[model samples]
Target: MGVTYRRILLKLSGEALMGELSYGVDPAVVHGIAEEVAELVNEGIEVAIVVGGGNIFRGMMGAAAGMERATADYIGMIATVMNAMTLQDALERIGIPTRVQTAIAMQEVAEPYIRRRAIRHLEKGRVVVFGAGSGNPFFTTDTTASLRAAEINAEVLFKATKVDGVYDSDPKKNPDAKRFKSLTYSHVLQQDLKVMDSTAIALCKDNDIPIIVFDLSVRGNIKRAVAGESIGTIVGGFCEVC
Candidate 1:
């Protein structure tokens, strides 16, 4: 089968790494994800990843509880580094050459974020895992994913979340909630559908990067998405999901 996106950026929430655990990364879950990613690599798809930090710490939660916002965000960025390292380890264990690049500059552990170098890595078929949420206090990992996808010239962005797709209401709370098979970025922003933050959605809208929102819990879903299968909601594109 032909690959739909030759180069794509995957946005993995820290919560996605939690799996059945209440907190932190799950080795089995991560390994399974790596194996699936390896299949994409075998199919000649270039992958870059941007991981979130909510599983360990959320900056907004700290800010809500009286901590300084910037400090809390910095701590949250560090949490993403830990998650990225864990993912890198899993990918490498399975023979996928991976690099963890942090925006905040922890040179001893990982490489500093350099746009050209990142693109070169992708061109060489190495999976580049981006961490630290754009090295800014206010930006979310969603925005980071958009930014990186644009920088790397990625054709699409895959948002792997706990939910299968963007729903009209909370799926868990409301079983009658309808899942959107496809969405436009403008509609997502205007309707406040929560596919991503407004900033994230706006960036993709401006750059023309399609964001695929899918459930990470489903096995082999990553490869399916790469093969252009309709396993989730496709934002900024047309085509109903099966």
Candidate 2:
């Protein structure tokens, strides 16, 4: 099979790491992700990841409860680091070389985020896991994914979520909800589709990077999507299967 993207960025949510569990990282899910990533590495793909911290902590939730915005965001960033470490351990257990990097200074546990160093790590066939959402408040991990993807010149960004793909409406509630096969960045932004945040979408649009959104619950979906099997909705470009 021809690989559609040789260099890709995988954007994983902390909640995505929580499979069936109410909160916190699920070992099985992490292991599954690591396996998929390993498959890609074996195929000679350069993969990078930016994980969210929603499973462990949500800055918005803390802010709703009256905590200082910046403080809550910083705490949430730390939560991402925890998730990243767990993922790194899972990958390394299976003989995959991995690196955990953070935006904020945490030299004891992870390397500080350096664009050149990260690119070199990818070139060396190591999976780089980026944690901490931009090291600033009011920025989401989605934005971080887009920013990092652009920085690394990734060919595409893959978003693995619980849902199968971006729907016109909540598929669970609306039986007739529509799932798009392909959409332009303008369409996603104009409709406010839940593919990603507006800023993230805009960043990708500016960089002309395509995004593949698929369900993480299904094993092998990552590899299938990477092989251009078209198992999900694609934004910013034509569907690979099409």
Candidate 3:
């Protein structure tokens, strides 16, 4: 069968790297994810990733205290850089050609946010990792994911979540929370599903990009999503039928 989704933007939460361990990057877990993604690359899928920094720092969390908004956001951005570097090392360690592009300017370390260059890397079969949350203090990585997905003209936005799919309620708190196999963008907004930040959902909706929420914690989920297996809740023009 032909490979599905020629280009995809995979949004990975830093917390997913924990892998049942402490709150940090787990080598085994990162390597496993990299290998899975590498398999998809082998199948000719162009992948670009936007990694969240929640595992290291969340500006809003500290902002609840007396932390300055700008300061806290800068810290959060740095945390994303760290996660990006870690993921870059992991992916490259496994022989997958990779590039780390940052929103913030860091010429000595990584390349600045160059949309053309990032797209070129993907076209040349390199995994591009986007870091620093849009290079702005107020915007979140979720928004950044949507923005970059559109910029790159990706076929879909693969949102890597802890759960397998979007549920009517918090699946962690309510075991009986019904899982949705798929969903339309209007349904996600109408039902008030917390699949993504409102800003993120709005951006994707306005741009007509599909957002696929799936459990990245499960092995091979990334590849499966890229291969268009309908493994998770897809939000866009189509509705998720029961």
Worst 10 residues of 1 by lDDT: 233-242
Over 1-242, each residue of candidate 3 has an lDDT whose tens digit, in order, gives: 35678999999887888888768888898898889888978878899999999898889987888899888988999899899999899889888899999989988889998999999999999999998889889788889999999999998999998899889999889989988877887788887898888889999999999999999878878877876797878888457552
TM-score of each: 0.97, 0.97, 0.96
Worst 10 residues of 3 by lDDT: 233-242
Please give the clash total of every predicted structure, in order.
0, 0, 1
- How big is the positional error of residue 128 in model 2, measured in Å on the Cα after superposition? 0.2
lDDT string for model 1 (1-242, tens) is 66788999999999999898998888899998899888888778999999999999999999999999999999999999999999999999989999999999999999999999999998888999999989999889999999999999999999999888899899999989999989888789888888989999999999999999999999988888888998889999763432
Candidate 3 vs. true structure, TM-score: 0.96
Whole-model alpha-carbon lDDT for candidate 1: 0.92
Regions more than 4 Å wrong, model 3: 240-242
Question: Which residue pairs in candidate 3 collide?
Answer: 182-240
Best candidate per lDDT, number? 2
Q: Which residue ranges in model 1 land beyond 4 Å of their true spot?
A: 238-242
